[model samples]
Target: MDTVIVSSQYQIVIPQEIRESMGIVSGQKIQMIAYRNRIELIPLKPIAQMRGFLKGIETEVVREGDRV
Candidate 1:
């Protein structure tokens, strides 16, 4: 496990090994999600990454086979 030290200035440097493994690049957007007792940092996924991902997930079908 890797740990980061919080400096008195309230700044932290993420460990290089962790950063490389997670493929986190400079200036990439991240999402901060708060769990019950912990915070999770998730990489922000653009809508383009979701292509064909949710094709089968069913939502309400509106006006099914509309009658002319």
Candidate 2:
């Protein structure tokens, strides 16, 4: 696991390797979530960039005859 130290100013610098692998660029918006006892950071992408993300997923589902 990667470790980071929180600065006195309550800021932490992301490591270089992690930043490069995650494609995290400066000024990019990230969502922070506090779940249980740990924090999670999720990169936020623009809506336009999210286009076709769900392509090729199965959309058909079997339904009861009455429902169908």
Candidate 3:
């Protein structure tokens, strides 16, 4: 696992390997969430870039007779 240290200004630098693998570029927006005991950083992508992200997701759902 990769580890990072928080700077005195309360900022942290993402390692080079992780940045490249995640396609994170300069000035890209990232959403930070504090969940349970750890923090999560999610890269935000533009709507145009999110096209067909769920191309193969299962769409079948079992429904009750009345609902169907």
User: Which pairs clash in the backbone of model 3?
Assistant: none
Top TM-score model: 2
Q: Report the lDDT tens digits of candidate 3 across residue range 1-68.
A: 88899989999999999999999999999999999999999999999999999999999998998994
Q: Which ten residues in a row have the lowest lDDT in candidate 1?
A: 59-68
Say which prediction, candidate 2 or candidate 3, comes out ahead on TM-score.
2
**Candidate 2, clashing residue pairs?**
none
Overall lDDT per candidate, in order of appearance: 0.80, 0.93, 0.96
Which scores higher on TM-score, 1 or 2?
2
Residue 59 CA error for candidate 3 (Å)?
Answer: 2.7
Quick one: ranking by TM-score, best first?
Answer: 2, 3, 1
| Among all candidates shown, the one with the greatest lDDT | 3
Candidate 1 runs further than 4 Å off: 49-68
What's the TM for model 1?
A: 0.57
